[model samples]
Target: MHYVKAKGILSAKNGMNLYRGCSHGCIYCDSRSKCYHMEHEFEDIEIKENAIELLEIALKHKRKKCMIGTGAMTDPYIPLEMELGHIRKAMALVCEYGHGFTVITKSSRILRDIDLLKKINDTTKCVVQMTMTTYDEELCRKIEPNVSTTRERFEVLKELHGAGIPAVVWLSPILPFINDTEENILGILDYCARAEVYGVICFGMGLTLRDGNREYFYRQLDRSFPGMKEKYIRKYGDQYMIESPNSRKLMALFHEICRQNEMLHDNAQIFAYLNTFEEKYAGRQLSIFDL
Candidate 1:
């Protein structure tokens, strides 16, 4: 791990990444793509020394309360977060300023800040977004070796729901010929249903492969699922979007299940919900005149 001073913290849309690079070791991480242009190794996490300070400044000056999001390029709950406590501090800032909060992560470490999350939600809004790609525990270990497994994440989701915190699930980056099966998708959706998640965001039944990430993914495939690399090369040579052959059927089933469970499956609708800021006690607070 290393630290560097950041020039700015929040993006135009109010999103911020307190760290660069990750140690999760997910084989299909798109952040490893060349377009991102990281100067250090992917495992050597680069901490933004002034991210929290900059966030406080940004939140203090904003004219309107809006949702503050993270974990777009890097998960905020990475292992280093336990030591640095950056995410927890950021959450405190967001709650102090009366702003909504949202985070996308695959780590159960997020449970450490459940109190802060609930506090923010009680005041405004707080949404926890978790990514679940593989349902099989053994396969989850092979792909996402360093982070929490799908079952563990399910437990986290249930806990969030029990605490009255809304949760969303990212069912994405499905690997073709690997985890792209009815059983895998159904198992994950079942978990989502049981957790009573607010929504499930799934682009489709396949993963993307690019220059940097594609090479790394192929290497891991060669190591874990020998002969798999050859099959992918022969099937999708130099293709960017590697869609599964059963994408149509699987997507239909996904939509049907979500509909049956009354969970939001429309991507646009779910994004709108995540981005919208709500003040739960806005008109309910008693004023001096009312008293």
Candidate 2:
């Protein structure tokens, strides 16, 4: 890991990434695409030395309390986070300034900051967005080798539910001809139902592959599945959106299950919820007259 001073921290929408690059080793990571233009290796992990300070400044000057989000470009709970504690410090700032918080991650390391998350949720809102792709533990290990398995993330979701914290599941980037099956989709949705997640965001039943990420993905596929790369090339041949052969059927089942479970399945609605901020005592503040 290396440290660099950041010119800014939060995005126009109040989202911040305290680090650049990742070590999770997920084969389908879109962040590896050249369009993002990272000067260092993907595993090198660039730390924004002043992210927390900039966040505090941003939060303090904001005219209205709003949701502060992270993990858009990179997961905040990467193993480096355990040593740096940037995510924890940023959460503290969000809580201190009365802003709602949300994070998208695939790591169970997020459990370390449950107390701060609950504290923020106690007065405002805190939502945890977790990504679950393959439900089979072995397959999960193969694809997301460095991060928490599907079962481990399920437990994290349950823990978040127990803490009265809302959680959203990102059921996405399902690899075609590998994990794009009925059983896989159903198994993940079952976990979401059991965890009582607030929503499940699924764009479709397939993954996207571009120049940089596509090459890396095929390389990993060659290493792990052997012959899988040839099959993808023969069929998809540089296509960006690699939709599953079973996309239509699986998506039908997905919507039906989410509808039955009463979980939000619309991406727009779920995003609106994540972006919206709420205060527990908006109009119930104690007045001098009451005292």
Candidate 3:
């Protein structure tokens, strides 16, 4: 791990990544793609030492309150977060300013901020989005490696539901023959249904692989799954979207399950839900008119 001073924190859209690299070690992480130009090792874990201060500044100057997002480019609750507490500090700032907040993550470590998430939601809105791909516990550990397994993430989703903090599940980067089977999809959907997830974001029934991530993925596949790399190269050489052979069938099952559960299966609608801030507490007032 290394610390570096960040020039700025929040992007124009109010999204901020407190860290530039991750230790979660997701095998199919898009953040590791060559197009992203990350010059260091993917697991080196770069810390933006000045991110909290910069975020505070950005929030204060903003004319109107909106949902502040994070955990897109890197997992906010990476192992280093337990030590640095950057994500916690950022959430504290958002709550202090009464700003809505949202995050997308793959780690169950996010449970630590459930209190703050509920607080922010009470004032405006706070939505927690989690990605769950593999239903088989062992497979999850193999791919995501260092992060929380899929079942643990499902438990987090259930806890969020019990907290009245609306949640979304990301069924993404389906990794073709590996986890794109009906059993895996249905098993995850069953968890989502039970958790009462408000949304499930699935762009397609496949994963995207390019340069950096592609090479890493191939290497791991050869080491773990064996012959899988050759299968991929033969089927999808140099292709960006390595779709599952069962794409159409799996997609149909995904939609039907989500629709039955009344979950937001549309990508655009789910994104809109995450970005829209509802002033649920807007009308609250101090009430002592007994003069």
Each candidate: what lDDT? 0.95, 0.94, 0.89
Local accuracy of candidate 1 as per-residue lDDT tens digits, 137-228? 99999999999999999999999999999999999889999999999989999999999999999999999988899999999999899999
Among all windows of 10 consecutive residues in model 2, the one with the lowest summed lDDT is 282-291
Encode model 3's per-residue lDDT on 1-291: one tens digit a residue: 888898999888889999888887788888988888888887898888889999999989889989999999999998889888999999999989878999999988999989999888887889999999899999988888999999999899999999999998899879977998999999999999999999899989999888888888888898779898998988999999888999999999999999898988999998998888666544442245522
lDDT of 2 by residue, 1-291 (tens): 999999999888888899999999999999999999999999999999998989999998999989999999999999999999999999999999999999999999999999999999988999999999999999998999999999999999999999999999999889989999999999999999999999999999999998799989989999899999999989989899999999999999999999999999999999999999987764343356655
Q: After superposition, how far is residue 266 of candidate 3 from its true place, in Å?
A: 1.0
Candidate 2 — which residues are off by over 4 angstroms? Answer: 282-291
Residue pairs with colliding backbones in model 3 are: none
| Candidate number with the higher lDDT (1 or 3) | 1
After superposition of all CA atoms, the RMSD between model 3 and the true structure is: 3.1
If both were scored by TM-score, which would come out higher, candidate 2 or candidate 3?
Answer: 2
In model 1, where do residues sit more than 4 Å from their true spots? 282-291
Cα TM-score of candidate 3: 0.95
